[model samples]
Every structure is written in structure tokens, then in C-alpha cells.
Target: MFCYQCEQTAKGEGCKTMGVCGKKPEVAALQDLLIYALQGLALVAVEGRKAGVTDEEANLFTCEAVFSTLTNVDFDPERFVALIKRTVALRDSLAQKVKAAGGKTDFSEAAFTFQPAADLNGLVKQGEEVDLKNASDDNADIQSLKHILLFGIKGVAAYADHAKILGQEDDQVYAFIQESLVNLLRKDMGLQDWVGLVLKCGETNLRAMELLDAGNTGTYGHPVPTEVPLGAKAGKAILVSGHDLKDLEMLLKQTEGKGINIYTHGEMLPAHGYPELKKYSHFYGHYGTAWQNQQKEFAEFPGAILMTTNCIQKPQQSYQGNIFTTGLVGWPAVAHVDDKGCPSLLDKVKSAVGLGCSSQGKDFSAVIKKAQELPGFAADTDKGKVMVGFARNTVMGVADKVIQAVKDKNIRHFFLVAGCDGAKPGRNYYTEFVEKVPSDCVVLTLACGKFRFFDQNLGDIGGIPRLLDVGQCNDAYSAIQIAVALSQAFECGVNDLPLSMVLSWYEQKAVAILLTLLHLGIKDIRLGPSLPAFVTPNVLNVLVENFDIKPISTPDEDLKTILG
Candidate 1:
């Protein structure tokens, strides 16, 4: 199997044996096949638009198919196998309807079909043979462009998938996903077609992101300034990871006042800032940092680990029985908490760890006492003073300040250091990069990536913290807002502003954001700890010439280069 849609791909190239993320060969092939089937389904939807397919049905199809392939989200082969067959059936039925209505169809000769479990191994062998046979494309550059577009859609699907789980689905976004996927599969397409899809992916993702922001903010109330604790209490605790706010919300509601202490883990760290979630009296602080640290972090914690979303490396057998997965996240042997939709992690919490009963009559004054000491300053409470909502809207509101700052040299350069976090040691570059940034410059960060330097006392500039945590990774929307606002204020393009995006990516969400930046023609983005293994040299050149994308170097050197 060949896969390279992430930073840690085998030896900085495609993973031929097994994924560094611990994805087995069969799973990798299924994911690729899943993506291929989704493209066919998209073609069906495009035709179904003329026939009678509802936008809601199309949206669900795109979101689920895309989210299923995101890094670490699903590993249950049985579920995926069933999903592929179902998607293929949907695609074929849509195609037949289109043909009957005399509408155009792009169903290629390479139409995907389902293989029963009994024939799964045979199909896998066929896929391997096809990979070997089609190893050489007629034009290498064309293949590279297709890779960029396909990977970008994979990223877009991830964000769209997350939004769907929250009951926020957009039909246009699904149409774009379908259209873009169909484009990648078209062997007759040219560079312009691929390039257009890339930019549209960015614009549509901006909309997809807005839907999620509304869903999250509307459901959880706007995230307020709140400090989260680092240490877990000496009791039965349930460590929750991944990026699903809704699932987290449900879990919090079910476990409330039941003596079980809910601790946020990994991507869920930002949940503490959401007012609705933070109000939970039993809700505790963050358990660990980022998805990559889970194995070691979950080992000693005295409770079950509920992974709500992706970036979960395969679990060790030590805690397999205690670990629980909900929603789309799955593993081989891990007990899945929810089969239909929302399952009772509440009951599981009680059964697995004794309902956190050790402190039955213990006083809770000490936990509250510890939290009062460290209140974090996120987006909510800083309104007017620091301009709380930097999401494209609020940034544009202060457009003049940014332009004036650049002109007066109060802020000579803008640094956007954002993306997902991982366990690799080279991640230190993010910390050093923030440290080495010039004093006259401002640092904008989002997502768990900011944890690298969020604690540093960078002081303030113009009453704004030099190191600004905009929001979560979805909050990269804020960083883009700041850039575009500055551009409009200066009456020049966003790239013309003195801004450099230094991004570190780990999962598909990062992939979507990077594509969005590329789509907007944002240039000179320095990405690392390494470039994606999936990108070929030809595709890299397209990005370099058009967008001037660069891989991260030493913090000091990159600082001089970006700020010069």
C-alpha cells in the first residue's frame, strides 16, 4: 500500500509498508478506496442535482466519507468496509438516475465497486497490482497537480466532517467537495482545472469553517477566558481527547454531579474556554498536550481514555479494555461506547473506574482554590481592549490599527505560527521561533500548536500580547482575517503585507487550512517539522513559484529570512 497524506509518512516519502500512524495496509487501501468511491458519489450528486437529490443527503454523504479518512479517526475495518459498499451503491444509483434523465455523467472506466469481506483480501491484492501497474503516469507534473487537489479535498472533507457531527452542514461545501473530487479523477483535466479547484477549496472551506464556528459558539456559548488545570486529582478520572465539542458536551452533561471528573485531553484543551462547558463544576483541567503524546500520557492516568476524534495512534493493549471510542473514531479492540449515535459513557465511567468514588465525602474546596490562581486570557473577555474576536470580522474592524502599525514600524512583521501538534522533538522550533521573533513583530497562533509557547511571557505591544492565541485550529480563520484586513488597509494584496505564515501540521485539519492559504494566494508559508510525503517535487515547484511555500529552517535563520 502507498500512502503519504501526513507529516510523519515513512522516511519523508510514501508509506509502503505501514503508516507511521500505525494504520495497517488494509486500512490504508480502504481509505484510498473510500476516497475514490466518494468522488464517484460526488459525480452522482452533481447529476442528482438535476434529478432530485436533496442537498442535505449530498452534504451528509460528503462529510461522512471525508471525515472517515482523516488521520486517526477510524480504524474499524468492518465499519469502513460496510461504508464503502454503501457509498458505491449510492453512487451507482445516482449515476443510473442521471443516465435515465439524459444528464451528462463522468463515471470513468475505473468505477469502484464493493467487495464482500470474503473477497476483501482478493480486492486488496488487486489494488496493490493496480498501484504497481499505474506507477507511471503519462505526465509526471499532471499527476503532481492531481495529488495536490486530492489531498486538499481530503483536508476539506475533515473539517466538513467535524461540522456535520455538530449538526451544522452546508450543501455548497459538499458540492465543492464533490466537484473537486471529481476533478482530481478526471485524467483529461489540465492545470487550470486543478488550480481553480485548489482556490475554491480555500474559499469554500472558509464557509465550512464559519458554519462550525457558529455551531460551536452557538451551542457552547462563545469561548471565554478561563485557565485550565494541569494536574489531575487523585480519583477516578476519564481523560477525553480529539476535536468533537458536541460529544464532549454530551459527556459533560451526562457525567455532571456524578462524582466522575472529566478532564480534557489533546485537541479538547480549548474546550475549557467555552462558557457552556467550563460552567460544569465537576469539569477538571487538561490532561495532556496534543495527540502524539497520548500513549505515554494515558498509560499512568488512573481512569479510562475516551478518544472523541482523530490523531489517536493505535492503542497499547495495557489500557485497551478501559479505552472507549465514540462517534467516528475507532480501533481494533477498543470498546466502542456509542453504536447508534450517543451512548452512555456515563454508565461506562461508573463501571470502568468505580464512578470516581474514592472522594465520596471529601471536600472540593482545594480544586477550586488551585484554579482561581491562573485564569487564561483567550478571545472572549478581551473585547474592545485587545479586540476579542479576531475572526475575519473583528480583525477587519481594526484594519486601520494593523496598517498604521506596519507604517509606523510599531509592528514591522507578522508571524502566523499555527497548526496541529505532535511528539517529534523538532517541534521545539515553534517555541524557539516565537522566542526569536523580533520585538517589533507580533505573533499570531491558533490550535493546540500554540501550547508550545502560549505560556511564555512575551509581554504586550500596543496593549496586545505579543504572542496572541487567536483560538483553536479552526480559529486559523482569525489569522487569515488579520492578514486580509491588513492587506485591504494597505490597499495591497495580502501577500504584499509584511506577513509570513509559519505552519506546523500533523493531521488533515492542518491539510485543509494549508490548502485554504494556498487557495487565497497567500505566499511564503514556512511549513514544518517536515513537508508532506505525498507532495512530489513537481507539485512543490508549483506551490513555490505561485505561493512561495517554504519548509521551516532553524528559528533564528527563518526569523532573519522572514523579517528581513
Candidate 2:
């Protein structure tokens, strides 16, 4: 098994035996094979589109299927097998439809004509046969670019899937996914072509994030400044993790007034800022820091836990039964709540794919039931409160004030400290960097990376808070919009503005966001805790030469360089 798609892959290279994320070799093989199956499906879907046949089901499934292959999302071999079969079934079915529509279907490419074995062992063998780690003959630079495109597509799929769940989608995004998948298989594409494709993936991710922002704001109302308690109220509780807002809202609806208080964990901490979600009286404060710290946090929580999307860890035996995964997240033998039944927010994900979206979602009654059975927060404990709800709308509402502060030099600079967080030691750089930001500067933060310093008392600049919580990684569009607006107000490019983006990346979604930044001609961005293993030195050199991207140095050094 060769996997190096995340920041924490083994020894700064591929994981040959197992994933550092606790993914087993078998599951890794299945995930690779799932991508292979999607290639076949995408190959046909591209042809189908040419024939004037656009299937919403096929489009949504492609997103879901591609999303499932992302790191730390699904770790169950059984789940991958089911997804692989589903993909192949959809592929063949689409091929027939294309044929009926007078599109050519006969192709000898292995991806087109390949058949899956009936058993798990046989499927793993098929996966090994198609594993590109050993099978590809492309130059290292081309392979690196393809990896970038593929990983970026996964991020696009994830954001697109979330948007669709909330009734927002664009067919153009689906078309890009199929076209990119087909292009990745092209042997004739050179480094320059692949580079353009990678940038295009970034542009596509921008749209996906835009759709997600629309879905989130349109349904939930633009986030208004709200203060969430860090304390735990005495009652049965459920800690919702991952980045899906609809999942948390559905659970909030189902668990309403059942003597329960809902809490957010990791990226879900930003949910408190959204007007529609925080309206529920039962919805309470945030519980944990970031995704990497889940095992400890989940263990201490007395009530049930629900993981909505990605950023899940192996379940500890103590909290395994209390933890449940819904939507695309999975772990072996851990109880999973499928997108079915009522009092659920996710069955709608399935219905949204084919059947029209309805109010019904994934059943959370079981999760609520588990909460009732456990001891929740033995007593009321006030851990203090933290401010959220500083997304684009809220920040822009005070944009005139912001512009004035910058003009008056009351705010000397703007720093965007955002992106995914990880368990590695170097991650502490983010915490220290935010702590050291001058009083005259403001830090715009988002995603789980903010957890490193979210609770810090950074004080305020004039009437403006020094720290702004922009929302999740899925809300990159909001962050981008903020930069764009600031750029426009200042009549200068984003890079020319006094704002610097210092980002921490851990997964494919981060890759997509980075590509989006590069695509926009944003330069001199500081990126760390570590660089991606998939990027070869030549590819890295190209990135550095073109984008002025730098691996992070000490926070003090970076701050001096940027502020000077």
C-alpha cells in the first residue's frame, strides 16, 4: 500500500505498510480501487454529457464517491467495496445509456472494460493491479501535477457534496470533475498542460466553495456575531464534530428539548456563529480543539458523539459505542448511522441525489438515545465563553470601520491564520504566531486551525476585534471574498494589500484551497506545518518560482519578513 496524500504520511514519504492516519493496508487498497472505478464512471459520464444526457444521480454520486476516497473520511473496507460496486454499476449503466444516445461506448482501456471480482480479496488484487504508485510511467513532475489535480478534485467533491445537501449545486462543477478525471488518464498531457489543469482544479474548487457558501448562508442566514459558552451545562449532551452544518442542524432539531444540550467540536465550532443553528436554545458551546485531538476529547465526553463528515479518528473503546458516523464517514465495526430514517438530517443527502430533497434527514434518534443513556457533564461547569459569528457578512458589515482603521494605521496589517490543523509538533507555530500578532494587527481565522489559538484574548483594534472567525475550511470562499473586497476597497491587488495569508494544511481540502489561492495570483503565502509528500522537488520548485509559496520558518521570522 502506497499512500502519501496527507501532511502526516510516514517518514516524509509514502506509507508503504499503513497510513499514519490509521488506515489499514486493505482499506487503502480499496480506496485506490474506488478511485479507479470512478475513473471508469467519469470516462463514460464525459461521453454521456457529449450525447446530451446529464444524470443528476450520476453527477452527485461521482462527488460522493470521490469524496469518500479523501483521507480520514472512510476507513471501512466494506464501505469502500460497496462504493466501488456502486461506482462500477453506475459506470456500466451510464455507458449503456450513452450507447442508446448514439455515443460511442466500446473502449479497450482497462478502466473502461475492467470487471470487479466478487470477493474482498479479489477486489484488493484488482486494486493492486491498478495502483498508480507502481503502475504509472509518467515523469515525476507530471505525476506530481496529476496528484495535485486529483487531490484538489477530492476537495471540490467534498465541498460540492455539502452544497448539494443544502440544495445548492451547479452542473458545470460536475462536468469539470468528469473532464478532469478523464484528463488525468491522458498520457499525452505534458507538464505545462498538467499545470494548467491543476490551476483549473483550483478555479473549480473556488466555485465549489462558493456554492457551499451560498448553501450555508442562504439556508442558515449570514452568520451574526454570537458568543458561545465554553462551559458544559449539566444534562444529556451530544458533541457534533466534522464540518457539515446541516448535520448539526438536523441533530439540533431532533434533540430539541429532550433534556439535552448540544455542543460543537473542531470545525463545527463555527456553527455557533450561524443564525439558523445557534437559535436552538438547546444548542450549547464547543467541546474540543481540532480534528487531530479528537481521541482525548471524545474519551472525556460523557454523552454520545456524532461525526458528520471527515476528520474522524479511530474510535477508542471507551467511547466507541457512544460515537456514531453519518454521511460519508466510516470506521470498521463502529456503529454507523446511515442516511435513512426520520428525525435525521442526512437521509436527505440520498434523497437530494435522486429523489427530490425533503425535510427528512439521517435518523439521529439513536444518537439522541445514546446521549440519554450516558452521564452528561455530571455538573454545570463554566469554562468561559468564546466569540464566533465573524464570517464575511458580519465582517463586511463593519468594513467601513475596518477600512478607516487601516487608513488611520490603527490596524497596521491583516493576517489570515487559517486552514486545517494537525497533531504534529510544528503545529504549535500557529498558536504562537497568533499570540504574537501586534495589537495594531487583526487575524482572520477559519477552519480547525483556529483551534490552536481560538480562545486566546487577542484584544481589539479600535472597536474591531483582533481575531475574526471566518467559518470552516468549506467557507474559503468567504475568506476569499473578504480579501477580494478589501483589495477592491484599497484599490490594490490582494498581494499589495497589507494582508498576508499564513496557512496550515493537513488534507486534500487544504490542497484545493491552496490551488485556489495560487490560481488567483496570490503570492508569498506562508504554508506549513509541513509540505505535502506528493509534491516532488521539481514540482515544488515550480510552485516556489511561480507563486512565491514558502515553507514556514519560525513564526517570529515570518512575521518580521511579512510586517517589514
Candidate 3:
């Protein structure tokens, strides 16, 4: 498979045998083919757009296809095979339309004209030919930049898909996805060209995230500072994981008054801040920590589990039958709910919960029965509360207070310790980093990474919580907004403010967010647990020279460096 597109790639390098995320060789091969097909479609779409011909459906498909290839998003080889075939059909149709419009079409381009093998072996062969390592470029540095851009696109596609579901669409972001993919195939492009495109990918991702933020806040109302229950309630329940608010909303609506309580999990933990979702009395507190702990946590939970998007690890046999996947997530033999039919998901959940366990050992009632006996959010209050909902509006609403605190020396610095959480060893750096921060500094966090010390009471400074949960990773846009607002209030640039970003990345979404931070000229950011395997030393040099990017040291050392 030779995939090194995630933080936990095997041995800190490419996964040649299988993905650490439970993706088999066949699945990895198919995902590669799917990406190649999407690139081909992008080539045709980019050309067609030159002639003022475009298809929103094609754009949306490209985004969703890339998103599905992200780590733990889909492990179903059959699903990738189907998507590859559909991509070819779409690409060919677009090519024909371009030609009909009197626009030049590249009939010779491999991405545009290559056909997949009818069998799995053929598909693997096709994938092997298009692997990033085998690209025409012989320079590892250039190839690394290309892969960075490709990974960034995957993140952009994910946020774009989320936005599209809420009826929010941005043509410029879609157009950039097609343009960048076509550019990636250009052998004539130089390092500077690739570097420029990588930054542009970050710029486009910012737009994608902004669009998603709009969609989410527009649909569910802006997140408010509400105290979320960190415990579960006493009743039959279902845990909703992943980052899809729409799916959570639908599930909550369908399960209302049906005796099945809904609890947020993983990135969905932030859903409690949304007034529209919390309005449902049945929508209780969050359960578990992050995506990496699901295997153990899911087994211990006494309710059915529904994963709505990426970050799904392979289901353990213990709760395998009790889990359901919807949206773009997939695992072989796992029941999936198609978004086209909302009722399908509800029906599947109902059926799975009602079936109970028979002699076949498929029963989830025991899990649920045990879950109710466990103390959840009700027991968490003794630890005190951490404040969230400090998104752009929330922060800006208290801009004067923050500014005054800074002037009064009550708040000394701001640290954005955010990004994904993984099961890997060095992740505790985040917990220690947040723990060691001086009380005078405010910690801004987002995504599942916040789970590390979210329950820790960091206390508040002048009425502002020391640790601020800035929504999910998709809400990085909000973090940026808060930064920009603070900069304006201070009458200085973001870098000039007493701010530092110590981020941990595990997947493509982190890559995109990092790129966006770079695109905004934010410098001296610290990234860990380790640098991406795809980032060659030469590329790293470029980042260090231009952006002052640094790999993380110990929390004490890094804190001294940043505080100094």
C-alpha cells in the first residue's frame, strides 16, 4: 500500500503492508485509485471550466471522494471500487461536454483517459502506477510538497462536504480544488510552483472551513456558552460520534420520546454548545474521549453507536454488530445508512437496538443495561467546568473585556493547543503543555484534542475562562477570527501578540488547518507528536526559514521558548 498520509503511518514511514488505521492492502490500493480517478475528473473539470462549463455535482463528488479517502473515513474496498467507476463516467462525460463546447480536451492525459482494471488485481496495478512515490518527479522535496497539497485538498473536501450538506456552497473553493488537482499532474511545474500551490491549498481550505462554519452556525444557531453534561443519563441510549451535526440533529429528532437517549461522542462533543441541538431534552451529555479510544469505550457503552463521518477505527468484534455507520464512513460488512434517505438511518438504528441479543450473541441490551448503571455527567460536576463557545462572535462580543484584561496584565498570553488526538505515545505532551501554562495565559483549543484536559479546571482570568474551547477542528475558522479580532483590538499583527500555537496533527484535516495557519502568515508555530513523514528535510527547511515552524520539544522547554 505504501501510504504515509497520516500521523500514525507504520513505523513513522509509509505503511507498505497495511494501514495502521485498519485499512487492508486492497482497501489502500482502491483508495489510491479513487484519488487518481478524482484527479482525472478534476483535470477534465478544470478544462471545462475554462470554457465556462462547470458541474456542481462533479465538484461535490470530487470533494466527497477525497474526504472518503481520509484516514479511518472508509475501509470498504467495494465502496472505493464503485466510486472509481463513477468517477470515470463523470470525467468522460465532462470531457465530451468540453469538446462539444469547442474547448481543447487532453485525450492523452492518463488521469483523463486511463481505464481501471475490471478486477481487484487490475485496480491495484493501476494504483501502483499512480502512487505519489512513482510520480514523474525525481526530487523528494518536490514530491513531498505535492503530497502536502494533496492531503490539504482532502481536508478541504471534508469541510466542503460538511458545508454542502447545510446548503452552503462556494464555487471558488470548488474551482480551486479542480485547479490544484490538475496542477499536481503537471510535470513541468517547479518547486516554487508546488510551494505556491500548497499555500493556495491552505488559503482555499480557509474558505472551505468558513463555509462550513456558516452552514453549521446558520443551521443550528451560533454556539452559546452552555454547560454540557460530561455524564450520561439513566435510560436506553445511543452514542453519536464523528463531526456531522445534521446527522446528530436527525437522530435526535427521530429518537425523541422513543426512550432512546442520544449522547455526543468525539468531535460531536461540541454539539452541546449549539442551542438548536441542545433544545432537545433527550440530547444528553457526551460520552467517551476521542476517536482512538472507541474500541474500548464502545464495548463498555450500553447503547448502540452511530459513526457519522471519519475518525472511525475498525470496530471490535465485541460491539461490531451494535454499531452503524452513516455518511461517508464505511467498514466492510458494517451496516451503512445512505444520506439520501434520512429515514434509513433511523430505521437501521431502531432495528439494531430492538433486535436485542439472541443465542447468536448479537444483543446490545446488555451493553446498554450496563451503561445506565455507570455514572456519567452527573459525576463530572465535582471537577468544576471548562468554558466553550468562544468562537468569533463570542470572543468579539467580549472584545473589550479581553482587551482590558490584557492591558491590566490579567491575561499575559494566548496559547492555541489544538488539533486531533490519537492513540500514539507522545500525545501526553498536550496535556502537560496545557497543565504547565501559567494562569496568566489563556488556552484556546478545538477538535477532539481538547479532550486531553477539557475536564481540568484551568480557572478564569477577569471572568474569561483560562481554557477556551473554540468549537471543533472545522471551527479553526473561529479561532482565526478570534485571533484577527484580538489583533485588531491590540492594534498589532497576530504574530506580534503574545500568542503561540502548539498543534498536534493526526490526519489530513490537520494538514489543511496547518496550511491555513501558514497561509495567514502565522509563524513560530510548534507541531507535534512528530513532523509528517512526507515532509522531506529540504521542505522542512523551507518552512522553518519562511514560517519558523518547529517540531515540539518537551512541554517545559517549549513553554520556556514561547514564553521567552
Candidate 4:
């Protein structure tokens, strides 16, 4: 098995033995087979669409299947096996429909018929044939472009799935996913075609993110500035991780008044800023840092834990039994909650931790016990407050102030130090980069990466906080909006503005966001901890020449270069 779709791929190359993310060879092979099947389904779907035979289910399934293959999302090989078989059936059914509609059904046999191996060995062989590198032409630049688009679609699917759960759907984005997958299968396509498709993937991801932004803000109101406690409370607690607000909301509703307090962890930290979620008195503060620290943090937490989405590391034996996964996230024995919100898991939490009973007549005791525990938020201290919820709306609300600050020279430059956070070396670059930003500059950040220096006192410039948390990685949309707005205000292009993007990528979501930035014609962006392994030297040269993309250097050196 070979895989290198993430930042932590083995030795910055393909993971041949097992995924550095703890995915075994069987699981890796199954994922490869699943992607191949999805491409097959896309081929049939694209042909059927030509004859006016469209399958929304096929399009949606393709998006979700790709998402499941992302790092840390799913580890159950059995699940992938089922998806592969189901996808093949779906593809065949679509092919029949295309023929019935009198569509031009002349396509490669591999696109029409994909028989997934019934055993692990057979699957591995099938996987080798369809490996990302092998599927492409021999040109390294073309192969890199194809991978950039494929990984971008995977990111789009994850964000689209989140919005879909809230009943938001865009037919065009789904159609684009199918269209792009089918194009990747074409051996006759040229370099220009691949480049155009990569940019289109970026443009489409922007729409996907817009759908998600609407779904989230519409469902849970716009996020507002709110303080989140970094400590835990006494009595039984349930630590929730990942980026699913809907799951967190349902859990909050179910456990409300049941004596079990809910605490946010990882990307779920942004949930505290939502007005509807914060209204729950039982809702407490955050428990730990980013996803990379979950093993140690989950083990130390005194209550149950729920991972609502990706970024879940393999659970340790210490907390495996108490950990539950929901949505697209899956593990071998960990409990899962479905879309309806699993209430049994709440009961399991109650039974496992004994949160159902307390001293002061069960009601007052929970609250009193929590109050007695170490205060998660020390109201008297400055460390308790860190500004967040500065998405497009909040930032645009103060556009005049920001513009005036720039004119007044109170704000010199804007640095977007954003993207995923990992435990790998050189990650400390982000912390140091944020720390070294001049006081006259504004730092805008998003995703779990903000946790690096979020608590630091960067101060404010002309009433605007120096460090602004811009929602999750998908909120790269928000960052783009802010940049466009600033550009309009300054009467110049985004690149001409006094702004720089210092990004750190760890997963496919970052892949999609990078494409979006490139699609918008933003240049001179710095990306690290290191370049993707799949990006060959020739491809890297193309990016440097065309888009001015650069790997990161030391913070001091990069700062001098950017500032100059």
C-alpha cells in the first residue's frame, strides 16, 4: 500500500508500510480501491449527465467516499470494503441508465467495470494499479496538478458534508466533483487542462465553503465574541472534539439538566462563540489544545469523550472505551452516533461516569460541585480572554475602523498565520511567527493552528485586536472575503495590499484552501512545515514560477523578507 495525501506522510514520502496516521495497510488499500470505484462512478455519472441522466446520490456518495479516505477520518477497513462494493453497484446502475437514455457510452472498461477484490491481497493488487501516481501520465507536473485537484475535492467533500447535515445542498458543487473526478481519469488531457481543472477545483471549493458558512451561521446564529474557559469542572464531564457544531449542539441538548457538563476540545473550541450553544448553563469551557494532543489530554480528562469528525488520532487503550465517534468518523470498537443524535451514548456516559447522582439533591449539587472545582475561567486574570469570532461579518462590521487604522499608520500589515496544527517538528514556527509580529500589525488566524499563540497578549491596534481568530479552516472563505474587502477599500489588488499568508497544512482540507487562494490569484504565500511529498521538483518549479508559492524559512528571515 502507498499513500501520501497528507503532510505527515512517512518520511515526507509515500507511506508504504502503514500510514503515519496509524492507518494499517489493509485500510490504506481499501481506501485506494474506494477512490478508484468512486472515479468509476464519476465516469458513469458524467456520461449519464450528458444524456440527461443524473444521479444526485452518486454525486453525493462520491464526495463522501473521498472524505472518508482523508487522514484520521475512518480506520475501519470493513467500512471501506462495503463502500467500494456499493459504489460499483451504483456505477453499473448508472451505466445502464446512460445506455437506456441513448448517451454516448464509449469509455474505458476500467471506468465502467471495477470489481473490488474480495480479499485483502486482491485489494492490494487492485490498489497498486490505481495508485494516485500510477493513474497519471508520466509527466511529473501533470501528475502533481491532478493530485492537487483530487485532494482539493476531498477537502470540499468534508466541508460540504458538514453543510449537508444542516440541509444545505448545492447541485453545482456536487456536479463539479463528479466532473473533476471524470476528467482526472482522462489520459489524453494536456497540461493546460490539468491546470485549469486545478483552478476550477479552487473556485468550486470557495462555493462549498460558502454553503457551509451559510449552513453554520443560519443554524447556530453568527459566532460572537465570547470567553471560553481552558480548565475543567468537578463532577462528570463529557469532552467533545472535532468541528461538528450540530453534534455538539445535540449532545448539549441531550445532556442538559442531566448533571453532565459539556466541554469543547480541539476545533470544537469555536462552538463557544455561538450564541445558541453558549446559552446552555451546563456548557463549560475547553479542555485541551489541538487534535495532535488528544491522546494525552483524553486520558487525563475525568469524563467521556466524543469525536464528532476528522482529526481524531487512534485512541489509546486508556480512553478508548470512553471515546465515541459520530458522523463520518469511525474506529474499530469505538461507539458511533448517527445523524438523529444517539441518545444511548448519553446514557452510556451517565452509566460509565456516574454523573446521574450527586450530593445536594442531584440538582444543586452538580452546579455547586462544578463551582467548587478549579474555575475554568479566572475572571480576574487577563489570560482568560482571547478574542475570536472575527469572521467576515464581524471583521467587515468594523471595516471603516480598519481602513482608518491603515490610513493612520496604526496598522502596518496583516498576517494570516492560519491552517491546521500538527505535532511534527517546525510547528513551533507558527508560535514564533505570531510572537514576532510587530505590534502595529494585525494577525488573523483560523483553524486549530490559532491555539499556538491564541492566549498571548498581542494587544490591539485602534480598537481592533491584533490577533483575530477567523473560525475553522473552511473559514478560509472568511479570510478571502476580508482580503477582498480590504483590497476594495484600498483600491488595489489583494497582492498589492499590506498582507501576507503564512500557512501550515496537515490534511486535505488545507489542500483545498490553498487551491482557493491560488484560484483567487493570490501570490507570494508561504507554506510549511514542508512541501507536500507528492509535489515533485518539476511541479514545485511550476508553482514557484506561476504563483510565487514558497516554502517557509525561519520566522525572522521570513518576516524580514515579507516586511521588506
> Could you say which candidate leads in TM-score?
2
> In order, what is each prediction's RMSD in angstroms?
7.8, 2.5, 5.8, 6.5
The per-candidate count of clashes, in order, stands at 0, 8, 6, 0
For model 4, residues 290-317, the per-residue Cα lDDT tens digits are: 9999999888876777888898889999
Poorly placed runs, candidate 2 (over 4 Å): 341-359
The TM-score, computed over Cα atoms with residue i paired to residue i, of candidate 1 is 0.84
**Which stretches in model 3 have alpha-carbon errors above 4 Å?**
340-386
lDDT of 2 by residue, 232-268 (tens): 9998899999988888888888887799999999989
The global C-alpha lDDT for each of the candidates, from Candidate 1 onward, is 0.69, 0.87, 0.83, 0.81
lDDT of 3 by residue, 1-564 (tens): 689999999899889887888989888878888888888899888878889888766887788788889888999877777778778877877788998998878656688777889977889788877776666378788889989998999999899988887878899999988888887877788999899999999999999998999999999999888787666666677898999898788777666666667888889888888889979998877778899999999988777788888989889898887788877889888877554323332253333221111122122333344335443233222323345676778778888999999999899899999999998899999999999999899999999988899989888998888988888999999999989988988889999998999999999999999999999999999999989999999999999999999999999999998888
Query: What TM-score would every model get versus the actual structure?
Result: 0.84, 0.97, 0.92, 0.91
Candidates 1 and 2 compared: the better one by lDDT is 2
Predicted structure 2: clash tally:
8
Off by over 4 Å in 4: 341-385
